[model samples]
Target: MGHSRFRRSIVHVNATLARVVGDEEGMSTAEYAIGTIAAAAFGAILYTVVTGDNIVSALTGIIGKALNTSVG
Candidate 1:
């Protein structure tokens, strides 16, 4: 019957999904890779913000003053 076929198809799809994603023991590498990529993206954004023009200019001024004071 069509109903039986549909049920079997659903079951087959579920089984395939489970096999692909249910192996938690072997998923740590994938999890770590994802975490590392996320962390890197976050770090890039943070670095950009910290190194923006205003912050860079402030740091440059401070260092210039310090250097001038030390030299003169």
Candidate 2:
């Protein structure tokens, strides 16, 4: 009786583990949603930085300085 009970417990544990492993539904969708939101937020930040006056002025200044250099 003790041996039979131990075997039954092991079978039950295995079945539970199998069910958990098989239940990977919608995980990819959740990951994609999170990735998309992160990308959008990053894009927004970059757009703001690039469109700001300071960054534009700095870029223009760099280009002007580069163009004004005289090569011997």
Candidate 3:
């Protein structure tokens, strides 16, 4: 009797786990949310670096050099 009860409990637990594992209702939404947050963070970092004074000066210097070059 105890053996039978233990087997039933194991089966019940397995069934519950299977149901939980098979359910993927909000997985896509969660993945999309994480991806969006990562993208936003990356964009913010890129914007900050590009808008910094050092980058601005480097870009300005490169442009000045390009414009000052003469065509032979």
Candidate 4:
């Protein structure tokens, strides 16, 4: 009788814990939010890699040429 009661109590505790863990009220939303933040960070890094310093230098040179041509 004592062993059976102990086993039943353990089973009950396990079931309750499983129920709480399986309840997904906020887990999916948090996952999506994290994914969005990661994607934005990746995009910013890619943009910096692709066009940052070169684009700035190119624009600066074009502006300098335009000013020199127009003034002289």
Candidate 5:
């Protein structure tokens, strides 16, 4: 009888703890939404910079220099 009561008390305590601690499912959804927006904005900015004439010409110059280097 005493052991049975102790077991029930343990179950009750666990239930109470679960209620207090809850879950992070909602928080995870919100965080993912914000992160996705930020990543998309960053990607748009990067695409603009990479596609500019200045960046293209600079990269072309760098590659040209590397390809033309004479072996010592």
Candidate 6:
């Protein structure tokens, strides 16, 4: 009895999975290409900003202060 029940449950699960996966859709290659380009452009801009003098100096100051803090 348990063995037959297990077989029926597995069959039902497979049918449900097939139905769900058959109807699902996702982005194609062109969309992926556009997303990749956008991400690279954003990374370039972020790198330029972070490497600028003002941000560098600010980060240096913060790290210096943290390192110089006294402990009891």
Give the candidate number with the greatest TM-score.
Answer: 3
lDDT string, candidate 4, 1-72, tens digits: 255774575565556445545565766666556555655655665566457687689889999898889543
lDDT of 2 by residue, 1-72 (tens): 255774575565556545544566755666556555655655665577679898899999999999999999
Question: Candidate 6 local accuracy as lDDT?
Answer: 0.65
Model 1's alpha-carbon lDDT is 0.64
Winner by TM-score between candidate 6 and candidate 1? 6
* lDDT per residue as tens, model 6, 7-65: 57556555654554455478566655655665565566557667989889999999999
Clashing pairs in 4: none
Scored against the true structure, residue 5 in model 2 reaches a CA lDDT of 72
- Superior candidate under TM-score, 1 versus 4: 1
The local lDDT score (0 to 100) that residue 65 gets in candidate 6 is 100
- Candidate 6 Cα outliers beyond 4 Å, as residue runs: 1-26
Q: What is the lDDT of residue 62 in candidate 1?
A: 94
lDDT of each: 0.64, 0.65, 0.66, 0.62, 0.64, 0.65
Candidate 3 segments exceeding 4 Å error: 1-26
TM-score of each prediction: 0.47, 0.56, 0.57, 0.36, 0.53, 0.53
Candidate 2 matches the true fold with a TM-score of: 0.56
For residue 17, give model 4's deviation from the true position in Å: 29
Model 4: number of clashes?
A: 0
Query: Alpha carbon lDDT of residue 41, candidate 4?
Result: 56
Error of 2 at 43 (Å): 0.7
On TM-score, the stronger of 2 and 3 is 3
CA displacement after TM-score superposition, residue 60 of candidate 5 (Å): 0.3
Error (Å) of candidate 6 at residue 31 is: 1.3
Kindly list the per-residue Cα lDDT of model 5 for residues 1-72, writing each as its tens digit.
255774575565555445434554555655556555655655665576679898899999999999999999
Model 1 is weakest, by summed lDDT over 10 consecutive residues, at 12-21
Clashing residue pairs in candidate 5 are none
